[model samples]
Target: MEAKLDLPFDADKMLAGLQRWVECESPTHDAEAVNRMMAMAGRHLALMGATVETIPGRMGFGDCVRARFPHESREKGILVLAHLDTVHPVGTLAQGLPFKRVGDKAYGPGIQDMKGGTYLAVEAIGQLIKAGIPTSKPVTVLLTSDEEVGSPSTRDLIQAEAARHSVVLVPEPARPDGGVVTGRYAIARFNLRTTGRPSHAGARLGEGRSAIREMCKQIIAIEEMTTEACTFSVGLIHGGQWVNCVATHCDAEALSMAKRQEDLDAAVERMLSLKPTGNEVHLQVTRGVTRPVWEPDDKVLALHAQAEALAKRLGFALPHESSGGGSDGNFTGAMGIPTLDGLGIQGALAHTLQEHVQISSMVPRAKLFAGLLQNV
Candidate 1:
């Protein structure tokens, strides 16, 4: 017979707690804002009697919060990985995506892209504590602050923590079909800069080589490198100090994603080998942070199987797939650890103005999370 799970999850209370988080607006680039969210999470964990520790952020990022629940054994256990940062800016809640509910959807900044999931996970643990239930293994929650921007500051920390834990569970938003994530595509970020001679546009246009023009050409070349296995896009660009002056410098950021590590390696080599079309302009390419592809191993599949069984007992079918996006799970899964991801609330339109979470998913997801916490 299967083990019984008693998870008394209150959707209204969960939404109320999630509202506090969504209203905080912890964007990735804003260290202060992200830290505020971390502090709030730390307090929540403390209230639940978990030992909470705040790790200071480096490289101008926000802090990370680690909460370890009381357990009998010191053996490796579950590592619940979550991120406190969102892509939305601070004023997004007040202007573009204000907190509100319409029909079955709750709209807010970062609600789907993960505040909703994170809160639900916390609620699951709190419920377990309230019910005086003990998990099969110890539980530790690591709330990271820089996952939105490739986890530049917290990558090392995530890897180190995962090394100590038996498995990793990422509450990144659930798939639209309520499936989980078993794999993630490889991702790479690149910074490009172009330099050219500046001159007065009207007086000496012929003497100037426009850096912006050269960058535009390079952007086209970079994007044209996309193939069936790998894809590239230039997302950020800055150039031209003044209209009257020929642009002397241009800088742009590009991102590439691939389904396999070998494909990403080839793409990265090509990106680094780019050269300016003409000798009149100078071009530089710098590789930024990268997320290695996470392919599910047998252990990962086994963990997913356990989750699938639990979901079925709760009257839900849990399908899983190798997803395209990157999450902190990529770090642990690539480290040869069993990792499960996308176990958060089910929703759509992540990283958009229309981002929202289905209100009905709160209870079921929380129960699933609680079941995992107790049995896995």
Candidate 2:
């Protein structure tokens, strides 16, 4: 670990940026709202002498922005990944009101989920500029538009971008009480549908095959395919038109987490092989969504330890928690790059009307992030 990661950084400017982001609304899969928020943040970044680029993401309404700060020293490279799209819908602007500061907290729709965290990246970068910290690697801020919806169009881009960097630092919101997510589960969602012949239960109960019955058997098999550390759940189940009619089609969603690639493949294969009621049932498995689980490589673990030491040096104890949730860090970690996550301010109630951030905590978190970027 380097001592520079514990240095002081500008706090006031960071808070202002966070405040500005809170005032803007960026919803998932809605490119316009995301673009609007990105533009606002880009203006300030431009004034800092950083070059900016924009790419239209796969989501019709989403935009991805990258702000590059050239490095003065010779080194590999660093990437900061954040999401521009939030979980809120388009109408959240009028629904929850503009961001308002309440004592030490900032309240709004997107504040805690991501917009506030996204601003932290720029805030920290700004502080690094003010401090005259000279990093060896060029810094790139990669903000994508489709994260909240599983990065359908941006996952490949994220992985490709990760290939160009030696390290990745993510500023997703910190865990409540200021801890970061250390290990993340890699996740993939599957939509499984079963097709069967339908029959009227009361009039001709034996005339048709029951898809619902087969689906129930498959779900039971799927549930049995789990261990403790990793498991599978049949989350969504739908079948039948009415109680009187045997269902001709059944649909369900399955979620699974893996510790490694082998676990993932085995799990998927097992789920897809389920046999219903000892009868052959036509099954279709389509991906619903996918997310990277935090399985940081040796580099990531080392960087996390370094951050812990840095926090102690800066007079705070920033412990980390193992997470079952997924994030962009998952993609980077899987690429074998050292990565750190949850560098944003500590808050709770993300993705809800209650989403809010500890307004006063922004200063210290930004300073810490700036310090980490300078040395990492």
TM-score of each: 0.98, 0.82
By TM-score, the best candidate is 1
Alpha-carbon deviation at 325 in model 2, angstroms: 0.9
lDDT of each: 0.93, 0.76
For model 1 the local lDDT of residue 349 reads 94
Q: Against the correct fold, how does model 2 do in TM-score?
A: 0.82
Local accuracy of candidate 1 as per-residue lDDT tens digits, 206-261: 99999999999999999998999999999999999999999999999999999999
lDDT, candidate 1, equals 0.93
Leading candidate by lDDT = 1
RMSD of each: 1.1, 3.8
Worst 10 residues of 2 by lDDT: 1-10
Per-residue CA lDDT of candidate 2, range 150-214, in tens? 67788888888888888888898998878787667767778888888887899998887888888
Tell me the lDDT of model 2 at 79. 92
